[model samples]
Target: MNPGLLLPSALFSLLALLLPLLIHLARRQQQQPLDFAALRWLGSKPKPRSRFRLDDIPLLLVRLLLLALLALWLAKPVLHGAPDRRTYVAVMPGVAATTVAMQALPANARKHWLAVGFPSLDSDPPADAQPIASLLRQLDAELPSEAPLVVLATTQFDGADARLPILSRSVDWRIVAGAPPSTPMVTALAAPRLQIRSDSAHRTQAGYLHAASRAWQTPAEFTASSAAFPNNQQIVLVWFVSDPLPTTLLEWVAHGGTVILDSSHALPQSRHPVSLWQNAAGIDLLQAIAYGKGRLLRFTRPLQPAQMAELLNAEFPQHLHDALQAPGVAPIPADARTYRPQTGANAYPQAPYSLQPWLALVLALVFLSERWLATGRRGEQA
Candidate 1:
């Protein structure tokens, strides 16, 4: 097979082949000279002696080998060898490994199964979660280009809709035309209890908390006492804290209890979704925040019932209901099966293989040998 060079320019290191010759000449043995008159008469009859000759033949061979190794290492040669073994199989999600082996695979090839759904060898794929397109891209980067991909999958109707990955190389697909496994709607065992510090002026925010808590089938209470302690791991909602943030509130947040902050207090930065209501003039309206386990909401201007009459709208309460819902509830499964390749869809593309690693390995061995020999020679000289 033809080989590829990563850094052909480094072949200039071959010029170092002359280094051994130069060193041998520089270290030539010295000849003894006789008395001037007698020596001159003898030289008149004798032909001139060469300045350099082969000395320490073994050492010369070793030095030549060292130079060649360095040149080859720098050139970085890689063989365009035969195709890699394409035995690794990616089993898609929404289909359990045990079930897939039963339906699609034979007894022999089933032994080398890797999860395509989650790309993990150990963990089971989530039932309701959607498949990610980036997983295959990651796989492509890890595996060698010559290594072919073999995909084993079914029509993933239960997961979220995602585009099928297009690989750089031709991938063999052994498709099982079947639906996804059934999904279970998971929920919390009991609704959480909520306590609110209410203000008559900020009734809008307080009302939302009360309504949202009830919508989630949880009990919500309004308390006037600032010193009241929550019972049974219950949550507290603060409309506005004019004084320092309640230490109790922070403790509740740290301990997994939610403390919904009011709009009157500046809230921490968060990535929660928010909904806004504006007047007919399209002026600035109130914004809401869902930070960590809690939520914060505030209006741009002073609170007015006339401007935010939509707070009492029926759909608005449902939004609050969704916002207040528990975080880990299982969602409905969505379908992500888009590409079922025909024979024509397959591809075979050339990819580069690097030789630097192998070259480096050999270079290290030669370098160590040279160092060992040089040290021994020094010891002998002493």
Candidate 2:
């Protein structure tokens, strides 16, 4: 519906009308009388009728009107306020905080949570774990511009110096971190308590050492060692208490492996599980963290089958749903009875096609008519 295109179309339609009129008038002026040598023979022979006869005017008008209507359509005529408007909200669940808060949310909240991870090409990639700005740009490209967006991060904004552009966009974004505020728009939930069970002093002490190794590997170790490993098989885990995890484990994660930790035995001396901890080096170690595009979820308490289901539901709801809803992921049914039922809408939306189909159909009809007319003329000649 561009006005510039419409103007040319209207001009073309007027030209089309004038063309037939001009032909008709020229034919009338060119008409001449001729004497027949054999009157009887001439009468018997098939006479070629006037191509511009008045009877043919109606059919010509039909053809001309069809062309004009089609041109107008090609100009992309559309009705205003047709309610075909589609809006979407990109719901980004924060790394640790959002995971726990989402668990406490009522199941009826019609929102989609995009799981954060690294981007991949071969398969459906997990969401990125970076700041909301990067995620917002990705979602902007993927979702409709008119859609609202809400970003839920696990980290509380202490009015930091790091500015995120996503905050300024004309979208509804709410950040939930630390304790929940009284704001109606945002809800905060208690961080899930994590308890590490250790029967022996050695295991308990080793866990802390492993935690130290992980902390040292960060900031510099993570970035410096990137070139040493394959892009798809980067080793992210510094150490596992039992043994140094094979390079294969790192490769697996780099190649899209999801490392789920049930660190029920990783908690400190306290009997009650601790959700937050600072290592001996004063580096903050939380109950859950994502490193090198892989997710690490440490559960302080031993998970029952039901608890595991709940944890999985909160952490990777889309993956869990896909595994259940689709038989292909595993031979698992999305039956509610099989698992603790956690129901929600699929996070991804389908692409939309508006006028492409109608245009294709109209083109097909025009070609078919031309073919039919050509065939009819050939049959008459035979």
Computed on alpha carbons, the lDDT of every model, listed in order, comes to 0.53, 0.37
lDDT of 1 by residue, 1-382 (tens): 6798878899899999999878877766455655676566564556476654333565667778888888987887877766555445666654566665565443334223232433353565544322333444545555666565666666553322122445665667666554555444322224555677755666655666577567767758878747665644445454444454654454333223445554456543322334444445875354444322223344454333564665666665555444445343222332334454323323445456777788788777877777776677668769
Error of 2 at 336 (Å): 33
In terms of lDDT, the best-performing candidate is 1
TM-score against native, each model:
0.47, 0.35
For 101-208, candidate 2 gives per-residue lDDT tens digits of 464343333344443342322234233322333444446556544444444433332111112233323544444443311111111112111122223323443354
lDDT of 2: 0.37
**Candidate 1 colliding pairs, count:** 3
User: Candidate 1: where are CA atoms >4 Å away?
Assistant: 29-55, 85-88, 93-131, 138-150, 154-332, 336-353, 375-382
